[model samples]
Target chain A: MSADVELQKVSVSFGNFYAAKNVSVKIEKGEFFSFLGPSGCGKTTLLRAISGFAEPSDGKILIGGQDMAGIGPNKRPTSLIFQNLALFPLMSVADNIAFSLEVRGTGKVQRRNRADELLELVALSGQGNKKVHELSGGQKQRVAIARALAIEPAVLLLDEPLSALDLKLRQKMRTELREIQKRVGITFIYITHDQGEALTMSDRIAVMNEGELEQVGSGHNVYEAPHTPFVASFVGENNAFYGTVISTNGDMVRVSSQGKDFLAKAGDLKDGKKHTFQKRDKVIMFVRPESIFLKDQINQADNIFSAIFKTIEFEGNLKNIYLSIDGVQDVRCSISNAVETATLSTSESIELKFSSRDAVVLPVGPLAVD
Target chain B: MNYFFNKNGPLISTYLIISIGFWLIFLIIIPQLYMFDLSFRPNIPTLLRGGPDDVYTLVHYKHFLFGSETSGERYNYVDVRVFLDTILTAILITLINLCFCYPIAFYIAKVASAKTARLLIVSLIIPFWINELLRSFALRILFAGEGFINNVLIKMGVIDTGINFIAMDVALYTGLNYAYILLMIFPLYNAIETLDKNQLEAAEDLGSSMIRTHLRIVIPHAKAGIASGCTMVFMLTAGALATPVVLSSPNTFWFTQLIYQWFNMNDNWPRGAAYSVVLLTVSVVFVLLMMKIFKVKIGEIVR
Candidate 1:
């Protein structure tokens, strides 16, 4: 019952400001796609556009090869689970689940039977007679899913459905939601500002910022090989060092900053290729915290550095060692608590090392700073 | 020794209890008890001559229950015909008000622009602050035989004669009863205004048509409002005397008007009190029944 969703150059403008600006993305059939961004970044606007609540100012929305320009929200083969769930408080759990069928003139007995089946699907089988207010937060979340699934719409649009739950419940629900999507096999378009939720549950994610689509790719690609600086900082923790490219070789680029020089793997750029960078062009080098290792335990490679250990935070599974490197200020190194030794302390001199391949060179943009 | 020092709590509570409790007893409970006592007294010698020597009898209650015979004429004491007429007319008026008020309340709450909504609500309140008597008199002038309505109808060639609009039931229902209807509309509008707009859109998104959306989603959500409005209108209409008295003939006296007659013209205070007690009981019963049927708590429906 899944249908592909295609938004062709969609733009939603509210008077002067654009809530979603010229966004174009295609969500494949049976795939879970997420719109990830901070609050007021137009992720919800883009989702509403797909759900037919907000018609795009200049664009075409297509579902299953059918254009949805003049169609109203009710006419589309899409169901939206709102942020608050919006369950009918006065109705019974079964009745709330079967509301879509009830509205279509289905008989009471048949609707209740169908509601019972869907309730079991969400693992709340025997609670059909309960009122919505009687259900716990997680149960209410499941009921909302059952209600959205009652219509068996081609696509289900969820607007931050997990935002209201506590942190642990939110994490547990992520797995449940992904499993449900697989079982239902419908195209799910989820909107959230939480990076963890998107990265964990979505098959592919589209990161948005200030009403602009930054990147659309799989979870790994978004986290590891982010196309833009915004994605690199937003997806996970990274220590960014500002520098200028001094020379470029076959597969490595040498950059110098604060009288310290380092080499990073040039994944996309090549040597003597009249690359876009002039000599001494400003650049940014991004390296994951986990890639930095203690120099005493490391076989030093191309990007080794020395720093002073300002503080050590023991986080049970890992030790977050904060450092002030020679050329980079306030750099953090995450080391796994792999050894059963004493914890590192503050005000200690330390050496850190990273291989050339572990560091990625990105063109320095205005978004280099946090 | 410290017992006296901790006496302030009871002292304050004692004064508060006396103030409010005594006020309630004097203002409400005492008068009601006095009325109840008077309702049991005799009616033959008339209550105008106040004395205990006049036999305390159930004759007035009997007269109210059955018809009375005076000399050679049979004068109905309770006036069942007028009583029935008053009740039926009151119910019909209340229903008509509900029909007229629902759409206006819905429009004001859900459809009107914010500025327009404010202006409309203000306009409704303006007529509300005007004295009911003055408003009823203005309506009387408008519905007079040769008033603006008949003149306009005649000038438009819709009618040849100036119609008798003032003493007609239509005038009572439409013009004189509008104030109560407006009162009913405000509460209904307030309730409907709190409904989530997204719920309506969600209904539509799920393939429910506009009529289905309103019937299944909007109206159910507005049930509390409907019950409150209907109850208020019914209660007010059932006990109303001003509109019917000023707008209708003597033959069209309402139940409240008859109750007034027993107390004033007829000097039958016992029967008047009896009729008032019955009216109050019926209004309370009806409100409770409506609350039960709608499955709404009385407190929720009221304020």
Candidate 2:
């Protein structure tokens, strides 16, 4: 029941604007694949294209080695869970879950049985008689998943299904969704704007922006070795500094920004080629806040810079220290919530250090913010 | 009283609320009560020719079931027959409107582009801005012995002789459907518009055909609007006086015409009042029945 999905130069254009442009990816069978991006980044559009809700202007999409050309959504062996879940409000939970069977003209007894079986799978056993409205939000979410699964689709497409739930519920459902996907043993293509969710659940994550794929890899690889500045800045909190490469040796590059020079790692990303940067090339170097530490914490590091402490933001378990380095880029470093970290809130100035291997630099391109 | 006072941020005083309440009773509610009261009494006009006599009887109500008591002929079931005919015709007009307007409503709300939707709405509403009476008259001319419809059909060789369509039931239904199309379309548009497009997509993704998508999902979601629209259209068509008077053939006698004749021509005010009351009761019953059958609440319908 599982099938690998392949997209080759897929492009979905709406008049003058391309919603998904030249996007290509290979989703393995029974794998949890996620498209992570900001709003209007074409992730949802690409999902729709895969589900056949949207047509590609150019390129091909093949499921199970069959080209999906001129195929409608109903004919595609794929099911899409809408952002709102879109459960039939007037129908009972069982009826909503068994709708695919009903549409295929399955008998009442069989449909009811299938519905009951799916409910049990989703941990909602013996609740088939209740109407959809009677269920809580999380229950409704499970019912939606059951409905999609009842169709026995080869690929289950979820378009930010947990976005409407509260934070705690969303976090809980993330694990539940992953468990369900594993149990079903089908390719699960998820579209979301939440990076934490993608990082937690996805076997492989595709970071998209402006209708194009910026980077695609395992969660750790994407975060630790991003191919582009957009992926580095967009995936997580990163302190970005724009400057020119003063020297290049082997795979290491010395980049200068705001009249200060810092050594940064530039080598072959594990199992992937590194984007080579030449000397005098203007580049935007990105270093994750969590990568930087107090100067005393790591002595004699590959890169070190100091700045005046601006403010500290307390976020329950962690605190972020914002600082300005020589009236240049604003740098932020996050530390665990501790007495020592709390005392730094009153500090006027701070010193920071990070290893060259922890930093990523790409040729000057469109920054995530601007 | 307090509700009204606070309705406009405390400026609506007790006196104002009382005055409006009295105005409603006098102008609307009281008249209905009086009509029901007069329906139970004799038709004898007083010396002053205002209100009914003191005596009350079931004769007027019985007259609706049976024939006129004073008539010499064995059968005078014209009033009951006309009443039934009116109900049947109103239902027909409502069905026609539903069939005609659902596609247009769905198109404007979901499929058409923003500019096209605006243009369609304006086109549908602009014609209804003209008085209903005038619109019927315009149709009357078009359906006359040598009017536009007959002339075009004749030229197209669809028919050799011109048909007198002005006095046909088709003309009446066409007028009723057009007159109340905006009411039906707006409610349907409002309901169907609020339906998240994802639901329709979800239905389609689950192997449902376009027809089944509407039947199982879109239509159920829009039951409230359908109930409200059908209620209004049925009531309006059944109570309409001008369309029947102008469009119906001499052979056709609408219930409203019978009421008109009783009140105006025959001066049988009691009988007219009885007919009015009966019509009002039937309309109310129909509204409740529609809501019940659709399982839509009053709150849902009004919205």
Candidate 3:
């Protein structure tokens, strides 16, 4: 039921601009794969190329080890659920679900039965007679899923199908979509701009930026060990200190920022990680907000910084204490709400420290800014 | 009525109401009432200056429908057939226009680029800017024995002799189709332009062939436009007088031409009014039937 998707240096160009430039990635069979990027980042273009709507200007798309260049979307072993759902508004719910079957010249009774079974699978069994307009947003999403599943394609391509729904429904649907993919045991390529969605449902994610594949790894790896500056900033909140490496160790490096040296995780030498940044190479040190702690909690660490507490942002469960440190733009410490956080003064100087393993240093490139 | 007051204050609302009342009385209701009265009474010439009969009768209606017998000959039966022929011709013209205009409409609305669509629109409108009567007369010359078409065909070695296109009803069909094409194209353009392009792509992605895509999606979505275009074209074609008279031979007469003869040539206003009322009834019933058949609402059709 599932198939691997491979692209061997596929490039999609439009006259002078390349929508997707030499992107090469593979989705393992039965894996929940996601392409996460902001709008116009060529994520959708890559998806369209795989689905056969967009013809790649160069290279090949191989599905299950077969070249899919000449095949169309209808002939290919893939089905795409459009962003708008594109459910036939004039058809009844059952008919909309059974459209693929109807086009294949299936018998009426069999198509209706299949529609009913899929409807029940989606938890909309008795509502098959209703029009599409009568259903709620979540129900329509499920109907679209059912419609695409009726083809029983090897890969199901979804193009931000949940973006139109409200937040609560969208959140609930993310789990349902993952469960459905697991139950069906098919390769699902989900395209979304929301990192939260990708992190929640995808087993592996390919982060795209400006028509380039920035990083491709599992959700945990992409979030915790981003390979580039863009991924470090875009995937989650991180405080960046721009500097250059002063020295390199076995799998770590000493980065100097504003005459202060701190040891951080670079990468494994055997695997050629961190793009193998050498001594005196310009790099950016990124530490997650949650990784930084008050100096008292950490007696000794590779990095320690002292700054004046400027302001505290109360965010329900956690509080962000903004600090203004000299020679650095600003440093922020994320601490759980407590009596101490509430009692912190605006001008009081404080010290914060983080473990060297928690801080990563990579060669400076593009950073995702607001 | 309260809409006027709500949108416009007392002064403007008063003016709106008065104008609406005047429009309805003088333009719509009074004319229809007069036609209804005329249809019910006997024909009275202007020279006689006789008032309508004290009691209304269906004699004029009967005479229009079933000709009055005189000298043991059927008098007005040909006109009745002429009326039926007129309706049938109108229906044929409407269908031809639909088949003819649908592809071009699709090209303009969905397929053509912005520049090409604009060029096509200008091309379609520029020719029709000429007066309709002159256009029909021009067509009459174009379809003559040695007209543009025959000359082209002969020069291309397709025909040995000149073809008489007008005598075979070709000119009438051509003129009517040309006249009412805008009514069809514009409505279809309006409808098809609003269809989301993704819907078509989704259908294609779902493995629907081109024909099935239209049958299940595009055509059903454009039903209102089809009904509207058909209704307007049918009414216009059925009631046409100038095109048929100018294009056809002397023996051919459209139903409107017969009605014209009754009112002006024969001085039978009562009979002409009766025929007109019947024509109006047919058109209304046709519109309703079209709406029913297409499963479209009157509001959707007019929109």
Candidate 4:
């Protein structure tokens, strides 16, 4: 049931503005792929292009080695669950589920039998006679999924199907969706802007920004080692420091900023390529907040800084500690509140330390870091 | 009870009761009761019959069903042919209007640009400003023998001689029928515009052909509008008197024209009232039947 998709440098433009510019990605068979980005980032546009709703201006889209240019949506063996569900309100639950079969001219008894089978598959048995409006939100979502799957298309596309649900239902539906994808073993191409949903449900996520594909990797890789600043800031929370590289060795580099020097691991930089810093060129270092520990508990590190506590916020599972350094703006550090009592107070001075491996030295550019 | 008689409550109740009572007495309840009472009375031997206390009898209804005799003259009563003609003509006009309006309404709702939609809507409404009689007369002048149409046709060498365009049913079909056609198209356009374009695309994506998509989705969704347009055209065309009088000959007299003849020309108000009551009854029944067949509420069908 799974089909591999290859988009080779595909670009879709509407007259003047580009929706997806030179985006290229290879999705493996049976992989749960998700396009994760903010709204208007062209994630849905790319999904629509793959579903043959919009033709690309340049480059080629291949589904299992078949060229997809000039193919109408109906001709392609792809099923898309729309954002609004689009269930036929006048039809019964069984009829909505059996729509694909009925359109294919299946007999009434056979269609009803198949609809009942799919209902049980979506855990919605005996719901065939119920009206669509009578179902709960979660049941309606499942009915949409069952309807899309009835055709047994090679690729199943979903466009923010859980966005309209409440928070608890959205979270619960995420698990159900992932489980269903696994059971069906089909290539599920999900599109959403929710970072948590993508990370939890996708086997591989393509993070997009401003109509461009930034990075595509597993959720762990995307969160742990982001290649671009946009990916780093978009995927999860991190602390960024502005600095300049002072020197470099085989695997370590020293960066200086505001009368302070810090050590970082050298990565992917060639000797002949133009480096952003030799002695005074500006650079930025990004470090995950959890990687920085309070100095008294630090046993191993290459960079350490002392700061005065400015504010402390008590979240349920974690406490957010805000600190102010002498030459830097306020930085936030998240500490797990495993115990009942608090450790630090406002205006108290504390030391924070991080290892060289955790600090990523990025080239300084115009893009701001959060 | 004291709260019910409070300032805001009694004020609102008084206004509501007075307004509703006025409409019920004058518009619907009183007029229907008067017509019912008038239908049962006998005509007096006078030049004009006025007021409701003259006589009580079933002679008017019996005369409507069977031929009747007055003091000095004999009159043919309402016949089955006239009733059938009214119903058949109403059905034909409704069907013709639907056929003409569907494509125009679909174009205005779906295909035309926003500016074009506004222009078409304005053009449809402009004819209403002219009096119906004046418009029908204007049509007569345009389609009569040696009128503008025949003159243009002859000058263009399409015909060697002038043709009597208004002497045929074509005049009734093209002239007065178009007003009801415009009315039908407006409601259809409103209903069709509410359809979701994405749903159509979804249907196509699900392997349904273009024709099937229209049949399964578009037409079913436009059911309410179709019912409303048909009802409006049928009711309006069936009861119309002026258009037929101007465009059609004496033999082409409509049912409403027959009712007018009994009342004014024949001076038999009771028989005319009975015919009017029957016309109203048949129109209401047909509208209700259509609403039932479409499985839509009457309110939904009209709007």
Candidate 5:
């Protein structure tokens, strides 16, 4: 059974501080939706609100078109998997998976059979009789998922369940979780601070900051065309330039930063409108590191700047070349390993270029804190 | 031993070891060994203590099962009844105390805010500053014929006359429950506090009711604390002397009182030693049985 969840202007406030403020969104049934944000950004709080552990200070939550006001978590048709999994250590694996059914007065034989079925579904067959502690960390995670699914909840809410696993295991479980969600055909609301994870697993991602939704769209749409400066800076590495709008034409704007004029594509304003920036209106322009190319790589571009190379950071497949333009903004240029390496020493002058279409200019606002 | 020496230096280590040795030998081992020896021997005159008349016998231990025929009693009805009554009453007190303290412990550890929890802890512990004897006496006054509670009930027209708490053994039960309640609350709080709050929320999210949550998740997690708390409370209530004496009516009899009579009033140390050994053995066995039933280990409880 799957149910679409809708939040109508929901706000969760703790006295003067709001954990989530005026959030309204509709999650489609059988879709993998993720709330992606940094710590203290209220993503987990919003997940808890849907699971009924946290009541909205204002507004309503509807599941399957039923209002959830005054309903305790036990009565809600949603299950939550905690960050730590919270499997009963004293119980066997089968018992842990079948706890919800047991509490609902299911017969022991049926419970065991259901538990075994779930174990095999999670690719952990014949591992039900062992104690919970006897399982590995990933095994415990599957057991927690089985326990949550045993209730046949219309929605499954996971609050960073793979955060505890190591990098390799976390990556493996990400695909596993996505596969499980598809097989179950239920609405899955995932909460995470990892942008890459959100991009990889979610059909649609909601980017949140300071208790408010910054942007909600497909992963490709968000990364390529972010609506806010926070989303542009937070989702991935970007070199930001502070300047004022010199002129506006169509959907492109020319901005002057540090005695230099640059042409850039104008993005939507904070209010989700096409903002036509007036002359001398303060704005911040963002360009992704990968978009900036070495002068030799791209012969001609709309924007070109020369800077002294500061350093080059070596990754396995790519290299990040950091440079300073007039000692003002630190610019980073990421190049693939397949490209020819620039034979330039530190402090050497180099030319960098990027197209105006690849750069986005937003109204000056709060950037994501590192 | 070597770690202690390195940690504290040889001089301080020697002093600590000597102190522990002296305590174990003189205070615990010697006294228990003496009592065990005396329980197997007969009570005789001092002049014939080492003589043939002072022989080892099973008479003292047998006296517990079969009464002294000189008193014309068919069985040791008074002592045996008192012993059984003590065991049953202690168990009841433990169950009642568990019911009373579990919610309070859960509240302080999980539900209450930090400030409220601090206030509650201070309130619960402040009453324990007074000596146990004084506390028992205070309870006696609270349950007296013209006590504060009875007086308030009468003035409020809730009762025609004051209920006899002492006559009904309510006073003793209240006294014992009050005396060992802190012992139960702290262990339970410690265990329940270590539980991740997510587990409780997880159970709730999985459609488990509040009562079932406790039955499945919370109580099992806190079993170690419960086992330790119940063990301490049961032993303390069964061996209690001052509270029962001060709060129980004349008709009530405690097993400790019979042992007191044999040792002090009758001046029969052998019989008293036999009764003491029996009570200690039974209490230890009972605690072990409970631990087995609950499937808890001693290491877990201590942790």
Candidate 6:
């Protein structure tokens, strides 16, 4: 029942401002795809373009290989779950789920049965008769999903639908959403700002920044092999080093920052081009928190630094150690709580090391704002 | 009562309660009770108090129903016609006001930009600052034989001569519609403004057309406001005095005019009280019937 969606250089602009600029990507049928970006980064606008609520100023949108120009939201083979859920407060859950069917002139008994079946699919069985407000927040979320699925759309677009829930419910709903997507076998295009959500559920993720797509890859690829500085910093916490490339060896580049040299992997040479880094080429290096280790815990590493331990932040399963390099830049490193490193006091000098493959070096460009 | 006192403090609460009591008793309840008493009795000379001729009777109500014996008509066609005309015209005016004000309210609340909405609301309120009587007179002049509209029509060669808008009851209809427009609009606006725009979009996104979206989502949500606005406009139009009188023509005979004539011109307070009670009772019942039809609760309407 699912159809692949393709965008050919789609752009949505409001006169002088571009909400979504020249974005082109293909979402495969039955694939769980996510657009991940910060607030106002145009991920929602891209989703709206697919759902036909917004018209792209340039290029074409093809759903199931059919052009979608001049088609309205209702005429399209898509359904949208709004950020607020948008459930009708005046209606019962069954009525809300059956609304699309009712609009198509379906009989009441059949609509009710379909609504019941959808409710069961969302794990909210026998909850069809309750008013919207009578349900808890999680129940309402499930009802919204059932309502969207009732239309049997080729593609379902969700705009931060789980954002209203608490942390525990959000985590639970994430898995449930993934399960429902698998069961329905429909193309699910999810939009969210939270990196954890994008990483956990998406079959593939598109990282967007300022109306442009920074990268499109799997969870592992975007986190471990980011193509741009924005994708590196936005997807996860990273220790950014502003430096210049002093030496290049094959796919590895050695960058020096503040007279301290570090080795990191270079970005892939695009289009089978054998591009080599030149000497004195200014670059930015990113090292993930989990990649950095205490020098004593590692056998040997390509790069090592001496840093002053500032403070320790205890997250239930992991401990985040804040450190400063040469009393200037803030560096963070995460280790398991099982490691008994509590003996180390604050402001103590500590040696840290990371493998060359753990850090990436790319050309200096825009980074994500906190 | 305790909550009120706690919220406002003893002194202010006492003052507010006393003021409300005075207004309800002396201004409203007492007068209405007096009218009720008078409506059940015959109109007689002051010296005939407690006499046989001054006894409580249904004579005034019967006079309202059947004309006076001196007129020699089996049934009171003129007064009855006027009574029915007043009700039907009032209903018509309410419907007309709703038709015109609904879109205006929607535009202000939803479609217009914030700055434009503020400007539109301010513009809607500015005309109402003037007194109703003054506005009605202005409308009369605008719709008169050689008034502004007729003169413009004549100049534009749309008509050979001026249109008699007054005699056709156009002036009265326009005056009353203008007079009670805000009553219909504000309630509708207040209701529509609180509606989530997402619901409208969701309905449309679910393959519902524009008309179906309004019928299922927007109208159901705005039902309270519609009922409130319709009830208010209907009651106000039925009891309206100044607009119908000031903008009156040969054909425009309002029920209030008859009540006024009975009280002032004929000095028959009993018949006037009877007519007043009848109009009030009918209006209240009609409003309740409308509320039932629309399935709107009084609490929702008041809210």
- iRMS, candidate 4, in Å: value is 1.1
Which residue pairs come into collision in candidate 3?
none
Q: Whole-model lDDT for model 2 versus the true structure?
A: 0.88
Q: What is candidate 1's DockQ?
A: 0.55
Docking quality band of candidate 4, CAPRI definitions: medium
i-RMS, every candidate? 1.4, 0.6, 0.7, 1.1, 0.9, 0.5
TM-score for candidate 4: 0.89
Considering just chain B, what TM-score does every model have?
Answer: 0.86, 0.92, 0.93, 0.87, 0.96, 0.95
Report per-candidate DockQ.
0.55, 0.86, 0.79, 0.59, 0.84, 0.88
lDDT of 3: 0.88
> For this target, which candidate reaches the highest TM-score against the unseen true structure?
5
Q: Give a tens-digit lDDT track for model 3, residues B1-303.
A: 677688899999999889999999999999998987887767765655455443567876777666775524455677778888889989999999999998899889999999999999999999888988999999988888889888989999999999888888899889999889999999988888888888888888889898999899999999999999999999999888888888876666798997888889999887788888999999999999999999999999899
Chain A TM-score from candidate 1: 0.93
Q: Is model 6 an incorrect, acceptable, medium or high docking prediction?
A: high
Assign candidate 5 its CAPRI class: high
Model 2 chain B: lowest-lDDT 10 consecutive positions = B45-54
**Model 1 steric clash pairs:** A74-B204, A74-B205
Q: How well does candidate 1 score on lDDT at residue A317? A: 96
| TM-score: model 3 vs. ground truth | 0.95
Candidate 4's C-alpha runs over 4 A off are: A266-277, A326-328, A339-341, A365-370, B1-16, B45-54, B69-79, B106-116, B141-165
Clashes of 6: 0
- Per-residue error (Å), model 1, residue A182: 1.3
Using Cα atoms with residue i matched to residue i, what is each candidate's TM-score against the true structure? 0.89, 0.94, 0.95, 0.89, 0.97, 0.95
- Model 6 per-residue lDDT at A134: 93
* Residue-wise C-alpha lDDT for candidate 5, range B1-303, written one tens digit per residue: 688899999999999999999999999999999999999889987788889887789898778978886877778887788899998999999999999999999999999999999999999999999999999999888889899879989999999899999999999999999999999999999999999998898888777889999998899999999988898898999999999989999899888988998899999999999999888998999789878978998887666
Model 5, chain B only, scores a TM-score of 0.96
